[model samples]
Target chain A: MAEIRKATGFIDWLDQRLAVNKFIKVMMTEYWIPKNINFLWAMGVVLMVLFMVLIVSGIFLLMYYKPDIKLAFDSVNYTIMQEVEYGWLWRHIHGVSASVIFLVIYIHMFTGIYYGSYKKGREIIWLTGMALFGMFSAEAFSGYMLPWGQMSYWAAQVITNLFGGIPFIGESLVVWIRGDFLVADATLTRFFMLHVLLLPLVILLLIAVHFYSLRVPHVNNQESEEFDFEDEAKKYLTGQKVESKVVPFWPVFLSKDFFVVGVALTIFFYLVCFHYDFAMDPINFEPANNMKTPAHIYPEWYFLWSYEVLRGFFFDIGGVAAMDIGLAAFGFANVIFMLLPFLDRNTDHVAPAHKRPLFFVWFWLLLIDMIVLTVYGKLPPTGNNAWVGFGATITFLVLFILLPIITKMEANCKCNTGGCK
Target chain B: MRELKILAVVIFFTAVVYWGVEPFAHSQMHPHVAPADFAFKDLGVNSKKGDAAKGAETFMSAGCIGCHGVSSQGMAAPMDHASASASFGVVPPDLSTAGAIYDKNFLAALIKDPTKALKVEHKFNESRPHPMIAFFGLGGDIDQEIADIVAYLQSIAPVTPMSDKQVFADACQRCHDIKYDKLMSTTDKEALKAYMGTVPPDLSMMIRSKGTEYLTTFINNPQKQLVGTSMPRVGLSEKAQNQVIAYMEKVGDSKKAEREDLGYKLIGYMVLFTLLAYAWKVKIWREVH
Candidate 1:
């Protein structure tokens, strides 16, 4: 508490008023990250970079983009692309970043899962991160409708229609959400407001909470190694680096974060320029037309997995509608992410998935099933493709449903260093 | 180095997923649609070498200029665009680029029976006649008369290397519009909807929506791409078809060349940054472990 003598002039004045030095020291310089962590740990900074990119590029696009049904299409296609100088570059960056950010998020989440990073004291961090994921998804879905293209229109229509699967308030809830009978002018304006204003503001708040929640538990290491953060950080700070198994957040750890971010931006810029078609669906190029529906309608690539789950239930049981069952499954798939901390029954051992055989199999199957569902989702859900999608959907359910059973058995197993009682 | 290996594995898995979801699914969804009768064998029409001079005379004597116009010859249709479209579902196109754009064999079939050539014969019968009156003859052989009219059109057509925009204007403007380019269909919108049973889509993003290959097959025969569609087959020649696609790319994807160029430069910047970052990171981490 008595470490620093009062500084002279403006420095002492500002420090006394704002406590800025103490805040920086508590948040940054004294923060401890495990030395066993890999470059995957840097995804937080990468996401921040992507968020800034989206916010800045989105502001530029909002300048010329029109939200009206009549003018929305042309304002983007003609006015933004043609009339505005270098608007395409901003759009390419925005489009490509919007797409790639999801990939980074999945990797980040999986990394957390693999190392048992959400276990014990780190539940808040995981919960906040998942909340951020949900917010970003909503932001993306809302932003998609602002373009008012064919895919944009139909995707909104299909998503909003999901509300109709509810038993009592289904149809009326949908009408209230859309503000119209069909996906029309009202839908566009409301989604524009969400994309440009409300959702982003919520996401920004969630990002701050997610980052702050990590300060207590600290970042998990690759081996699930636990140590006193104060001791390791003090050792590193006093220049006894070899004895410490952690690095200070400011200078050493950020060096790795910066390098990882550099690599990520390289990959991102490459896609923005050379391979942008990955995000830009050709079907979306045509303006929204209620009269002419596209031959095939599908959601964006990132949402394809759950979209497949929603499309998988083809048969109804007794009197209930099959669509309602599929809708429930879709909701389960998304909500399961938030329940990871509670789902696993093993409270004693916090170890990497690879150290637990059954959980290892579960993790890999979940990843593979997600990829399969995504690919099959893009294909028309008919004939053999329907069967594959069903199998993938069932596999995803089974994997999550098995998490409790597998972790319980691991908890009761004979004594061992990993995944044992 | 160990962390880099983990990254490599992740990159490898990502590449596999990308291939499966994108290029692989795209190929499965839109298989290549083959061209419809490239040789025009099903048409069953034979012709002779026509004299351009005789064709020019027949163009007038046969009263071809009554409804259709040859803008190259300073011939305009008798009616204005509005009245012509109202009366005949679409305004008769100027035949200036017809010969250059439309295949010669297709042209001859179109003149003989306009309905059969456009493959909209399904919509037409004895009671509902095609808008274009069939060419009977000028008190002479019917095939020879058609050949003469075709020759006159070919002679009037501009030579090779016409701009892509001109080719599309000459061929598609009668029924379609590109709002982005500020170009509208010459025919009335309601008339076009009545004629085709659906309003034609704007061509501004056609190149992106339907790629070069898809557009080629679609323009060659609409039925092959979208079965039971009211859109008639347009008989643009292979060269002219390519030109129309090029023009679409120009308007729809105007920033393509610039985007590609800037992408490479930015990637180079990224490479330089990565190298510098690698060195600095290595220097900083040397203090630990």
Candidate 2:
């Protein structure tokens, strides 16, 4: 009887642990996806949703698509035109959502960058996000080829050729990548496999890590405090709390997030239903023919900024090989940006707003310059493009390096006045 | 530890299977002439002056000569070559006479648009097989090159035949093939008299009476052409109309499924999609949190 009673007691203890485990699991879910997150904070969730949509829709598309250059285009048409019911709709949804999701994520990243979301313990999350962005771009690049359209063919040709520009093993690397001498059946098949399967799997694992890292430290909403007249007056004169107060996560703050998500979804639905945002141009409907060059070759809008940058330096070089080398370096430099978090030297410095004023200012200036350069990147090829691109690059460096210092100075100015206290 | 081991084992097995299966299937499937690929390649090629000689050379050098005979006779269907003959597991039409019998423009249009070609040719007799397959649009200046080849074929003096439109109205338009099997062989005037004698119309100028627009529309959308008629819609091929019109504007006469079972299949899918959409909206599993 005593043994039975002890067993029961043990069972109760086990049940208690299980209950706690269940609670932790629930909390983790909400923690990873914080409630009452603003639309800006919801960028991670949006990216996650977009990734799932791409994978699932891509799987359905893969059913009818032939990935070889010879048959890839036809298979795509078959998916769109024949066989599956409403297959075109799925493909378009995947394509359009990709652009929208990435656009939101970029905004999220920049906002974080500007507001010092990468400061102190939050560096890991920002770093993971940048890595995800790079991978997302790669995913987009691979998926573009599955359509086997004119632009699809040329874009692959141009980008893959960039790898060949890497001295020494460049030519062999290109051959190895394409599985053929050119972007042919082998290239299409490989790209389709990667786009639909491999990249997505990697992205999912990375996202899991990204969110896990985010959960370690709750969202720092210091940026949400707008510069107000009252705050300014209090800082200079009375030194009272003048900014709009932060509400708790359960109700007030959380409801704002819900409203933003609802609005975003409504706009997304409108784009899907009425606009059908994916490109379905007549030229795109045509299959990729390697022998012929397309009239205009441009990357998708999200990559347009980088594409513009690359094109800006297309002409200026000491030699043909040197020009190619320059292009290759620019592409590599993008990947380097992903490593920024680890590269940051100064840490444990409080009042980043005051201490890093120059860094913040220059970062903002660099961002604007990059945007301007990207715009100029779209212009017709000319000798002057290089000069403009170089100037823009200089602007980029100044902002990236100086903005942190500017923000730090501002934070120091506030502290000295006893405003922070 | 046990669960982790099991998961590791499962993952290992999965990886092994994926690596083992993917390479073989993908490598084997890589080189084949997917119908879409063939169609798009054909579209990219200009058919106006298709030089059988130049095409023959390309066909040979591209490894097409291996399966397709030197004389242009095709072989068994393989990955690289799309054997129309191998389709339906029978001896199909010969290509040697296709240029002569079919209009040159029709051939070009077939290369441009396969579905449109099938729908047009399917009109003559429902029993006649149509080898319609997938098509991919192509890039490059393939059209001009194909035009050169087409010109070469024309130089060969390929024998041309009576246009399909001419033969159809004269020989087979009167009796509806779908409705009356016994009257299937009946010609236009006789069938017309049998059906409506007093208002019977002459078939010779019927094409001229209807303008190209009307004829094209009539040929493309036959359901809208003759209401309550048992004749299947054998749509007009763009090439056929273009070539036939150029060849002989002076001659030839032109004259004109299981609802319940198909409906159920369509309705079933609609219901399924609706339910799926509702499920996505509700996200019932998420509510547990």
Candidate 3:
């Protein structure tokens, strides 16, 4: 009896240290996540998982890649064609995952914007998330150059020169980033180190901080006001108390996430395995030949919008030189979206029809403008057509500059009339 | 729980659709191929005694020496054997094997017509590696000079045998001579005069082949037209002329300037770019935030 008592005591002590409740206790008891969070709220978790997938795959790639501009393209090719088994597979997965991660993050950002998650207690979280997003973009930019292919070479050349548009220090800044005049071995190696090591380390730290901030304040589930919790529970899950609802993560959300991942993986795999293409051109394999410029120069898709915006101003009000200013402005505009919650004082935490009339109209308008710019980005330039540019400028002003003013005016009027709650 | 499940499915689909398709959709999916025109498969090395001296001369004068390195020790890059085996690519031909690989007549013909060389003998399995830039002439006449060059190549050393010039280069203890005046004068004054007097000589019909240094000096200096030379004095400044002259002896006509210029231009642009990037970071992004 005495020996059995001693064994039970040890078992109890182990349970205290390792049980699910033990770990869950700190998160569940101290963290302020609202009990009412829906599956829509689970995107944060999904984003986190996608991030993990990218980091692991990225580390594997680093082991085989050589970043000297002379050898980078060939090294990537070597990886895909000769080096690692399923190396190409991992590379594709990582790339496709990047796009997916961005898409989810964008939606999450906008969701926060729509629901005022960036207001009040969540402002720090908002700031941290934006920082992460910025870092993520930098990571992508550096990684894109890792292949050192034609597109990678030219894209780095074009974007790095974008810094040259600055009034005084632009050219110097670009040189600093490049370490040499052209995107050569130095640029390749530096970017590789940053992509594979530095930026990722920053992201990991930032993501932890981002989540910690999220835990300080419970999530805002204000959108639930429209649904009668009791009635919805009965209709959806058979008379369960709204707060009583829960499910095992492993076979439920995890299964769904896996299914989505499977489909995505299939598409990525097919493209990489069957339709393999590196960004390099065989001519580019010789080395960077300055005498010959590739006939077409465009940035990667992630940077297309800013590239198009810069091009739009090339011959408009600005000459080729001043176009940098316009490009700078365009890039600056995205940053504005990131910093908006701090500027706005409203505390409403729902994507309701009312509280933010100005925000929604302008939101969609900016999106439409981006789409238009993207399409226009595909067109060849015609120097004589002032009309088209004037039209675009007017459209831009109306959507971005004018509409916000008008919406604000309308909001103030409604508030004065005591219609705002 | 069920409503949560529904939302999860929708989110999942949205994610899937947003991220998939591009890698599958692009045309010409393999790493891009240089257009068929750029692959010079038939390019064979020059191998004629009549023109061997001239071919050697041309090789040195044209800046090919700068990139290929002295005695073809191989400088810079892309010195791979397999790539080297390809008949022609962007990289210039290795002069060391010129004797064994090509006939003197073929070398003369290539000098006469680069495009023809690119299309024919220089090609290995594909097309030309570089578009045939006409450093010789666009059009006119070519005949006897080629024959003389080939004859000269054959008389001195058969294309199949290791030539005396290659042997001289290997045997001579190379020195850094400050005897620039002597070296320059050897080809500078007389050779340039001869080359300039010829004015884009008929490469296809060489009567007697001259050295590349002779041709380069002549091209750079070309005697005054009033002085009875077909080559005009382009009024090249002393520094400019000497640069071309020293270049002939030392580096020759490789891509040093081109690469250097690009580096400078890119640096200039980068400065401008960083300023604007900072502006976006500060003036616009910061203010808006």
RMSD of each: 2.3, 19.8, 17.2
What is the docking quality class of candidate 1?
medium
Regions of candidate 2 where Cα sits further than 4 Å from its true position: A1-38, A224-258, A277-282, A315-325, A342-346, A349-360, A383-390, A401-421, B1-289
DockQ of 2: 0.02
Going through the candidates in order, their DockQ values are: 0.74, 0.02, 0.03
Chain A TM-score of each candidate structure, as shown: 0.96, 0.78, 0.77
Give stretches of model 3 more than 4 Å off: A1-20, A27-42, A114-116, A222-289, A316-321, A343-345, A353-358, A378-421, B1-289
Q: Distance from true position, residue A12, model 2, in Å?
A: 12
Which CAPRI category fits model 2? incorrect
Considering lDDT, where higher is better, how would the candidates rank from best to worst?
Answer: 1, 2, 3
Give lDDT tens digits, candidate 3, residues B134-219. Answer: 34522222344454444433443333534333332221101111121122111222333333232132121010122243334443
* Native A-B interface contacts kept, per candidate: 0.76, 0.00, 0.02
Query: Distance (Å) between predicted and true CA of A412, model 1?
Result: 0.6
Itemize residue pairs with steric clashes in candidate 1.
Answer: none
Candidate 2, residues A1-421, lDDT tens digits: the string is: 2232233476466655565545643453222222222345545555555666677877777677776776666565544443357665566567667766765676677657655567577777877788788788888889877778787989899989878877799999999998989888888888877887788888888888887776565565543232333343334233222232322232333343444445455555445444432333334654566766865576665675566556545444566653564575476458656655544444444233333544544555655665555544444334665577666655654444554444445445545432132
lDDT of 3 at B172: 18
Task: Give the least accurate 10-residue stretch of model 2 chain A, judged by summed lDDT.
Answer: A29-38
Question: Against the true structure, what is each candidate's TM-score?
Answer: 0.96, 0.52, 0.54
